[model samples]
Target: MKIINYREVPILRQSESPAAGKIWSAEGSISQRRHRQTRNGDIDMAVGDSLSMDEYKLTLASPAKVVPLDPNLVLPKPTPDIETAKADLKRAGYAILTDVFPEELVRTARQVLADEIKREEAIDESRVAKFFVDPDAKNRRLNRLPDRHEVFRQVLEHPVVLELTKHILGPTVLDESYLVHSVDANVTRPGSGAQFIHLDASNGVGHATPNQSRFIWCLDEFAEENGATRVVPGSHLWNPEIDPTGATTYESVPAEAPAGSLIIYTDMLLHGTGANISENRERASINFGITTPWCRPSINFPLVLDPEVMKNTSQTLRQLLGYSSVMNGGDYPWESAPESIRSLCVPAKMAY
Candidate 1:
């Protein structure tokens, strides 16, 4: 296990000998480190003698012990593999998974989004308009997608998504596991302004570790002119004290890709929606994400999901929706009074 100095640990010199104060040159000869200290009068030596007995009083204090890094604070490095996506994630905190979604699926999903948007606008223009308003007109956002359509469920259970999600967040439920955070979509229309840069990680400043990650499934081609996502490269590894939102110094580049590509990124990486200056192009993407089982999901799926949608949903999908299994503690215990939802749960085991 890697160890790091805790906040309370004081910085101390390594040794307390005459040689410890000396700077060693590449040739193994002493430089002028000790000489500089003597000249500054920072160190004073005291000597005592009693009946021919001699003693020396040291100035430097003993070295402090290093604290083992808190497990919660430790951000696990991606396991190196033949896949370029994993390598990209380790290097830049984000990766583009090419051709993950098929052309047919993308078309169908896009149609569904268009229909949903029309229905939402018809129902309540004010509410729908407010969601689309990222301080601009024509742009919009769709929320609570799992209950709305089956294609989203298929997107949620994609083998690639499950594999990489497990790769980023550990497979085990003890420290990490995949739990659906939220399923939403963004529609950036022409003339829309850029959204503010932000971090998706909960309490990102204090708890800098990555507990969440996202998969942005593009429904349409993302281009710089049509408001593709702008990401700050290598920003995930930055210190928590550095706030990228208000700071104008950080450089963020557009993550442009084709219609079917997947933009996978850790929640800690700084990112924002780019402005759409194009004449007619409208950029659309399904923003889906998973958080560690211990973290509270952004959407309470059990409450919001329609009963009919859960009827044919897969056990894994149900589990992702906060049913079954045990980690820090099981989400919904099977031993409870309800028998209809028993199929949603698995044999539970506590993380000890």
Candidate 2:
């Protein structure tokens, strides 16, 4: 595993480290991260901010051992292959699919997102479409990504991602009704502190498995310094109500990988983004979820993607984007109505 600083470990002796009785509470806001309240009461801090040797001196005092990553952070499992990837994902609640897309394609994908962000930001200075840039100016999640570029449409159905979705969710559960829950971008700007260490969903995880999973294609090389994703390995096995804060170390190992690699993880896994200490680097990634049909997706696909844009996209892309919800028994107004009747309704403001 590529660690940001092994040197922070040696700053304090085993006893001097403030490992015990340190309190962690979620205060201020969600993005600010839950701060670790040192026992002295004079000091308190959050994770995303660059840790000081003083904080390390205190944090290391906890029983959370600062050990080198074991079994590695990014799975070495070869992929575009199913069985190996499946095995790793099942075991760890996550897996890495290496070299699934070429480096150039991934580079262009990042560029496409960058352009979209710029264009969207210009339209509404306060709010950029679906993205709500955090107050810290560090992390921005670009929602409704499929609507932004045709290239993203290709990314949504990448072969390995599809296969894994099928394998994890299974044919019985899927029943040909799998849907794209959300297609978005996770851009960690320089100095963007680490994100809240939490699961995507708390239900059906740990005690039970979930139907939703994501394949986050790395659009930039993920390194410890540039805010690579952090994972607590197998925290998916904990009970549903188990608190992650004091129960486990938020001191996570960075799942460092190449730009074209995909980090596949279930919503259940305990994970968060590392702090980007770099002054001039951003960790770019595409969060594409292939999920079961039951839940209302993270974004209402049809509402966000206008018909004009859908016309130019491929049929597969169109379906994934919920254009074919009509085909999947989602037809409420009229089952077999003409296109006009299907999309339109009698005027609500009609006069006699």
Candidate 3:
């Protein structure tokens, strides 16, 4: 058996020998035999190894077992009531809740991002430059590229948000969605024009469907001068082909929510970020999506979470990422767990 450490592998205790205690190191790695003996008359064979000992006293330990420190971590306080938010969701395409997250969390997250940007900047300037400015001037709207930012993870798992999402999308709703892009002005250059008005799920495999929703969190203050997101309220009821201009007189309202405020909406809503005409300051917003089991996510979450992160994530988050099942859906498409869960389970099958 492959062992991560000596503790993981069983050891034979010297006192357990029924005959004259014969000390033979399985690998001769430990020179001290006295240290290897236990008070009980039994061999401490490493896990997966067999040893003759008092059946009652011998303990079996599996390295794979994980014990979490806190299983029921309460969610951070919410700024807006969930019922009110749900009501808004039905009335308008989106609803904004102000000051939902703790200010400290936002400040710390910003610091973490700034440090990461600085480090990445030192490594490659040109590569990081693309993260800020639009490649095509015509499509000048800043796109915040999301790739497992620490703050993003924190925001995604926040309890209040998750609870609200569950209430709106149904109890089975998971945080399958994540930040597709994070647009920041400091990184974005001037003349970054408005993005083409579009729906969040236009490219989604399940478009105009009932099982999807997006939850956008404003990490920084979003304002009219700083390229706040513009939206057409009640546009979710319209068909996809509807033109932006001729459409039911859209309103380009500034999404000026304070930091930690969240904007929850249906993916079908027509919205676009306004141009960042500001000279120095940049607007930063984190966009995350949540959906029912039947829909495909905007960003492939299972692919991004590394093994370590996956192991550390909450069961709720795992289910949200399509790592678990809801009842026995069998082998139907969208019925089974996502490919990420299949990959994680393969090693377990091999072990048996």
TM values, all candidates: 0.71, 0.71, 0.58
Residue 262, candidate 2: Cα error in Å is 0.7
lDDT of candidates 1 onward, in order: 0.63, 0.59, 0.47
Model 2 over residues 247-301: C-alpha lDDT tens digits?
2333446777777888888777766667778999989998777666555567767
**Looking at model 3, which ten-residue stretch has the lowest summed lDDT?**
1-10
TM-score between candidate 2 and the true structure: 0.71
Q: After superposition, how far is residue 181 of candidate 2 from its true place, in Å?
A: 1.3
For 1-352, candidate 1 gives per-residue lDDT tens digits of 2111111111112334585674312111132111112233222111111111111111222213221222333232222232777777877778887767778999999999989988988998664564522544568888878888888889988888888887787755553336789889899999776654457775555466687878889888888789888766676777464342221224456777788888888887766777777999999999988888777888977667765668887767876776655565545565763555655554333221
TM-score of 3: 0.58
Q: Of models 2 and 3, which has the larger TM-score?
A: 2
Report the number of the highest-lDDT candidate: 1
